[model samples]
Target: MAYQQPALPYADNALEPHISAKTIGFHYGKHHAAYVNNYNNLVAGTPFDSMSIEEVICATAGDAQKIGVFNNGAQAWNHSFYWNCLSANGGGKPSGELAAKIDGDFGSFDKFVEELKAAAATQFGSGWAWLVLDNGTLKVVKTGNAQTPLTSGQTPLLCVDVWEHAYYLDYQNRRPDYVAATIENLLNWTFAEENYQSAK
Candidate 1:
């Protein structure tokens, strides 16, 4: 049950012009990978050694004694989900049920993008901005550091990493630019749709 950095769905360079290969190289290859490594080591030979990352996250959440394990395990799962939330063929508007749901929940897709970007841009520090299903209602939520929506019983449909490491290389101090570009060109609506369907 050792956790590993999940493979990128596309080439590191595939998201070019929007997000650079170097960013993914560092973000996915370094930071994300490090979290997985830490998670594996922390849980080794412990009762959590046999638990899935999500299970460990849920079990240890809010327990100060296992905070290290919770942080690393949550990051491992979050990064895996974050990777799938982007794609070379993604971004722009979605179609079908996802489209209808976005309209229903956020008034319109543009508004949803606005809200998502604002949340990501305003996050005080290393954290995540997410689109999640909370009690069957679509909502936007932000979690600081290694926190995740799952611990709050929300099913995350989409997420954008707001940690400096996620954008510093690509957008420098221009976090808003990075957030805007990712929303416009990198978000994988298909993946979001699948997650939404499953959550429902």
Candidate 2:
């Protein structure tokens, strides 16, 4: 099972106005594909080659000999999920079960936004910010380059990539602006809700 790049859930232009098509094109096409390719090559002819991408990532994550594979595989999976976390029509507050969970865990939806933004903004370097479910409780997590909550056995409900490649084209050096806009306008709460429920 060689790692294969998943197609974007929507067209590159589908996220336009918030995230430009050109940005998505390069991010998904060049950056993400390179990771997938690297993962496949690194694991070629190894036992890990037959494992699913997620399985390989989890299995090799702590093995020093497989560090490169773990990084590439996890990064490939993370990028795929991150792209799906946005939509042109997405954004706004979450509703229903996800909304209830946010209120239950974060005191209120607004507080959740504040904390999420803070996490994304203060990550200090290239990484990711995520809303993850751990034992049915929601929490904000920050991961360094290629790291993922999956490595720690948490279920990621929604995520924003803070890697420079993700926003450099559209947001330039303004990562905070990108984070604010993403949380306010491009979040796919429906997808987050689905992931939240499924994690149970």
Candidate 3:
């Protein structure tokens, strides 16, 4: 089946102040949609034509010759996941098992935020910072453009896209400001919890 662009979990204007509708419009409607469209084209006449996005990502991972396939497919998957990672009335902190896991793994939610902030801020260029389940252990990891945890053994719980396109229209060159706002106001901990339960 040809991959399609997934809709944003919330309305485009849902996350205001923290993430404006204009940002979402160009980011999701344009940037993410482009990846979805490109992925479909790249896989149209190849083995990936019938494979799931995850399968294409895994199959092309680390194969330099298939970098285009990897880039488009992984970016499609990543943006889908990224959209679910945000919410209008989300963030603050989690409760239940997810809370315990965060505290246990990172000492405190503050520390986890600190770590995630550092990851996104220090990523150097376009990339992502993630909180993932690695060997049943909660961990934070970051990857460069089009790289995703799906190709790695870890299971991603939450992610923040630090690509300039993700925040340039809103926060401009201050990537840290965008990262901080997304973490504090847009993070969907409930979605993270759901991903965690499935990971285990």
lDDT, residue 130, model 2: 97
Q: What lDDT would each prediction earn against the true structure?
A: 0.92, 0.90, 0.92
RMSD of model 1, in Å?
A: 0.8
Tens-digit lDDT track of model 2 for 52-134: 88788889888988889899899999998998799888999988988988999999999999999999989988899999998
Cα RMSD (angstroms) for every candidate in the order listed: 0.8, 1.0, 0.7
lDDT of 1 by residue, 53-139 (tens): 899999999999999999999998999999999989888899999889889999998899889999999999899999999998889
Q: Which candidate is the best by lDDT?
A: 3
* Candidate 1 off by > 4 Å: none
- TM-score, candidate 2, is 0.97
TM-scores vs. true structure, each candidate? 0.98, 0.97, 0.98
Instruction: Write the number of the candidate with greater TM-score, choosing between 2 and 3.
Output: 3
| Lowest-sum lDDT 10-residue window in model 2 | 1-10
In model 2, the runs with Cα more than 4 Å from the true position are: none
At residue 136, candidate 2 shows an lDDT of 75
Assess the local accuracy of residue 4 in candidate 3 as a C-alpha lDDT between 0 and 100. 78
